[model samples]
Target chain A: MIVAEQKPIDEIKKMVAPYQKLLILGCGTCVKTCFAGGEDEVAVLASALRLSFKKDGKKIEIEEKTIERQCENEFIQEAASCVARNQAVLSLGCGAGVQDIARQFAKVPVLPGLNTTFIGVQERPGLFTEECVGCGNCELALYGGICPITRCSKKLLNGPCGGSQNGICEVDPSVECAWQLIIDRLKTLGQLDNIRAYIPPKDWRSSNSGGPRKLVREDHII
Target chain B: MKTSPSNLQKTLENGKFAVTAECGPPRGANVKVVRQKAELLKGVVDAVNVTDNQTAIVRMSSIAASAHLVQMGLEPVMQMVVRDRNRIALQSDILGAWSLGIKNILCLSGDHQTFGSQPDAMNVFDIDSMNLLRMVKNMRDNGKDMSGFELNEAPQMFIGAAANPFADPFEYRVIRLAKKIEAGADFIQTQCIYNMKRFKEWIRLSREEGLTEKVYILAGVTPLKSAGMAKFMNNRVAGMDVPEDVIKRMEGVPKEKAVAEGLKICLETIAELREIKGISGVHIMAIEWEEKVAEIVKAAGLQK
Candidate 1:
């Protein structure tokens, strides 16, 4: 899932300072799961902003609204009335969602309230770690499902780089070495030979290297 | 068979004990400092490495500094890090550096942005060092760009990469080296060597894999300026293993003569490194003290 963290209150306040009427649009999918831009978070943030404005003797109207997913045009259409009522929208979504909202509501100024971090999984409650870098070519099958691209600090295809101490990366002691995990997993599966194969350098064309990516489906075109 | 005008490559090819040095470009636009440092290393080393925003700190572009060095008649290894640039920018810079007569390129996965002045900065790690090596190799060998498009004229670059022997998963370090060689790395410059025992073991394992014949391995060495610096590197720097005895030796030295003692230690390490079978040369990274390079290289008897 796409993970993101809320911007600091001061920065968010400054961003919305110019607008008299603002809409805090929340994303229900990725940002919702990450607790950055969700229904509850938007309410909490709106209340805090209201309290802050009230303390400063300022008058402003702030509305909280969330859609199923901001990336899709259909979901973004649900917030049309709120977007029309407000001078600007403070999108609490991933980068893609923020852009999507901006594209859909051409005249309204869409501001990002969350910093999209990475595509990761929740290791446990309240703890999230990045897992995939979305490097067009996926080689997880060869490494026994452990991605060397996102897991290794160096993104070494033929790692673990010299910094894995006791299965922990030298960069961060808390972070487990991706290669060590791969080795262990491969060992368990009796697939140690898989690692021995020299994985050549990856082709970054499919990644963000070329430019912004676009997916097209001919069968679903209609 | 000749391609680049890199003296470092020539020295390594001739089976000679090559010596290279590193110089971090100034944080601001000060080409004079870079020129002075390049002049200092003129005849002292085989090539001078121009670091790309080393330690995540913003500095003058390595390519620009390397171009200046090329004009000064000094062969420079243009350090290109993956942290600050996407593939588009990286390829463009590589081509620009080549057009400027800069031949050597050292690909590195730069230090994370958090370590630098701009902690809030977004990093563009479009490709890692290994892939950078492959990209450069393809551009040089196949005369094509990342998209398999043909280039008007491909750059002839002597590609280099970095290795940290002191990093964790010690046993896997050699395997990584082999992979780098396979990825088209013509040479490698390692992280600073303070723990000789571990480095020797790494070299032994590398030799067993016959990787020594595939690529030139230059062991990195940095002279300790003071006991505090030694302690800082030992404790704070990730992947750095400053030996306890080396720290103790630096501590044993008097305050006024600590640098001298450190230089002596560096000389001894370089001498010992020359004896290691797989070790081809020494890469002296006299950070911020480029003036001491000539003296250290001369004292180490690496001046050819």
Candidate 2:
């Protein structure tokens, strides 16, 4: 899931302050699951913003609305009426969603209320750890399903650097060393030899290094 | 046997137990600091390793510092970390460093940025240490860059890599060393050794795998300044294992006597390291304490 956290209410307030009529847009999919931008969150944020603005003796109107997903045009249309009525949209969506809304409603200003962190899964409630970097090329099979490119602090492919101590990364004691996990998992799968093979220098051209990537699916286009 | 223009390599090749010391560049652009450190290390060690922003803290460029060492009639093993530079900058610096008469290069995946003064800095680990080693090897041996572009003159660097016998997944450490050797490392400098038992085990495994014959292995030794430093490293420093007995030994001494005890412990470790079959040399990392290096070397009877 796309994990993100809400920007501070102060920053959000400053962003929406110029507009008298504002819409607190919520994304119901990834951000919703992470509780950053959801129906309940949007309502709470709306109430908070109202109280904050009222305290300052400023008269501002806010409307809260959430759709199934902000990425797709169909779901985005659900909030079209609310978006048109407001001067600007305080998008409680990921960066991509904010851009998507901005692209659709070219005139309305779409401000990002949440900071899109990473493409990750919730390790536990309120705990989200990054698992993938979308490097475009995946070598999970060789690493026992562990992604060193994403998890390892150094993005080391050959093996763990000297920093891996007692299954913990030297970069952060809390973060488990990715190479340790790979070695253990490979040992469990009886594929320990996989690690012995030298992984050559990664081709960064496939990753974001090449530039913003695009995938075209002719079969799904029709 | 002279594969590169590295005096360190020649010394090791001539069946001599080489001695190398680390010299970190100053935090600011101060040539005097580097020269002062160089003066202390001059003639005491075979080659001085100029660290590239070690601990991820900003420092004077290693290349510039290494060039300074070259001017001072000292051989330098310019450490290159993959954390800061991409393939382009790394290759460019290799050529530039070699041009500046720097012969030896230590390839490393540098300390993470979070541990440094600039925690907010973005890191560029475009290549790992292994890849950096391979890249340098290719540039030196094949006379080709990473993109297969032929170079005007190959940077004939005596490639070096680091090893940590104390790091976890203990069994695979030897395998990693083998991989480093295969990747084109002519020599290996290990992380600081306080755990003799584990270091011996790692050496035994390396010997069994015959990795010792493939690459020169330099045992790393750092004189613990005090019991507090020992405890701090044991708990905080990554991949550093200071045994409880060693810490107790340091604590047993009075605060004023701790420095002498630390030197004694270092000398004892050097003696033990000398007896090890696969151990080729000792790389002393005095940290900010470069003055003690010559004294330690002379006291260990390594001063030629």
Candidate 3:
């Protein structure tokens, strides 16, 4: 899922300070799952902003609303009346969500309230770890499901790179060496020979290196 | 010798044990530092390796420093790391270095930026060390760029790569060495050796796999300045293993006598390295202590 963290309250306040009437929007998909932006978070932020503004002797009205997913127009249409009534939207969603909202309501200013970190998984109860880079070319099968491109510090194909010691990465002691994980997994799967074969230079054209990528589903288009 | 005009290549091809020392470029644009180090290493070693932004700290460009070495009548093994530049810059520097009369090149996946002065800098590991080796070899042998465009004139370089015998997944080290040889490394210079047992085991495996016959193996040796340095490397430095016994040996000496003790240990390691069958030569990395390299070479009886 796309992981995100909410912007500091002070920064969010500064961003919405110019508006007399503001709508605090929340995303109920990836950001909601990560607890960064959701219905509960929006209500808390709205109350905090109201109190913060009142203490400053300012007259500002704030409204709270959350959609199923801000990226889609169907959910965005549900909030049309609320958005039209407000002067600006403090979107507590991922970067994509803020942009999608901006595109849908062209005249309204949609400000991002959360920072989109990475496409990752919730490793534990609250800990999130990056698992994929969306490089467009998936070679996970060869590496026993561990993505070296995303995990390894050097992104080395033929690696470990003289930096792996005792299953730890030289880059940081806390991070597990990706090559160690690859080697151990391959060994368990009886596919240790997979790593022995030299992987040629990666064709990065499929990655972001080629530029901003666009995917079109011709078969699904109606 | 046919592959490159590198003096180191010629010496290795002639079946003579070669000697190479590392010369780290200064943090600032100081030509005098490079020249002073060059003078100390002039007749003591076959070729001097000019490090490229070693430890990820910004330094004088390795290509520029190597060109300076060429002007001083010293052969330089220009070190290029994958952490700084992409293919275009790497290829361009290769051509530029060769044009300046530099012959040898060492391909390395440099030290991570977090270890250097600039921890906030973004790295450009567009290609790994293996890719760099293959690319250099291709440009030299096939006379074509990575994109298959025929170059007007390709750089003929003696390609070298680094190895860490002490690193983990110990059984896989030899396999990686063989892969490096296949990827087009003419020579392999290992990380500093303190754990001789591990180094010997790695070499034995390499010998069994016939990797020794395919590429020249230069065992790396660095003289420990003090017991504190030994302890620091053992605990802090990643991928480097300094055994407790070695640390004890250094600590056993007085503080004032530690330098001499360090040199003695280094000389002893070189003597032991000479006895190893598959070992081709020694790469003395007297980091910031380049003057000791001359004394080491002379004391090891490797001085020409």
Which ten residues in a row are the worst by lDDT in model 2 chain A? A195-204
TM-scores, chain B, all models: 0.97, 0.98, 0.98
**Tens-digit lDDT track for model 1 on B136-250?**
9999999999889998889989999889888766766787788788888999999999899989888888988999989999999999999999999988776788989999999
Give the count of colliding residue pairs in each prediction: 5, 0, 0
Give the CAPRI class of candidate 3: high
In model 1, what lDDT does residue A216 have?
A: 94
What is the Å distance of residue B284 in model 3 from its true position?
A: 0.4
User: Each model's TM-score, in the order given?
Assistant: 0.81, 0.98, 0.98
How well is each residue in A113-210 modelled by candidate 3, as lDDT tens digits?
A: 99999999999999999898888899999999999989999898887889899899999888999999999999999998888888888888888889
lDDT of 3 at B82: 91
The regions of model 2 sitting more than 4 angstroms off are B1-4
Tens digit of per-residue lDDT, candidate 3, span B1-304:
2434688988888888899998998989989999999999998899999999988889999999999999999999999999999989999889899889999999999999999999999988889998899999999999899999998888989999999999988988988898888889999999999999999999998988988999999999999999999999889887889999999999999999999999999999999999998888999999999999989999999987
DockQ for every model comes to 0.39, 0.82, 0.81
Q: List ranges where model 3 is wrong by over 4 Å.
A: B1-4
TM-score of chain A of each: 0.98, 0.98, 0.96
| Docking quality category of candidate 1 according to DockQ thresholds | acceptable
**lDDT tens per residue, model 1, A1-222:** 999999999999999999999999999999899899999999999999999988988888999999999999989999999999999999999999999999999999999999999999899999999999898888888999999888887676766654566677766778898988998888789887787756655777788766988889999998
Which candidate number would show the highest lDDT if scored against the true structure?
2
Per-residue lDDT tens digits for candidate 2, residues A1-222, read 999999999999889999999999999999999999999899999999999999999999999999988899999999999999999999989999999999999999999999999999999877999999999899999999999999999999999999899899998889999999999999999999997877788888888899998889999997
Kept native contacts, as fractions per model, are: 0.46, 0.74, 0.72
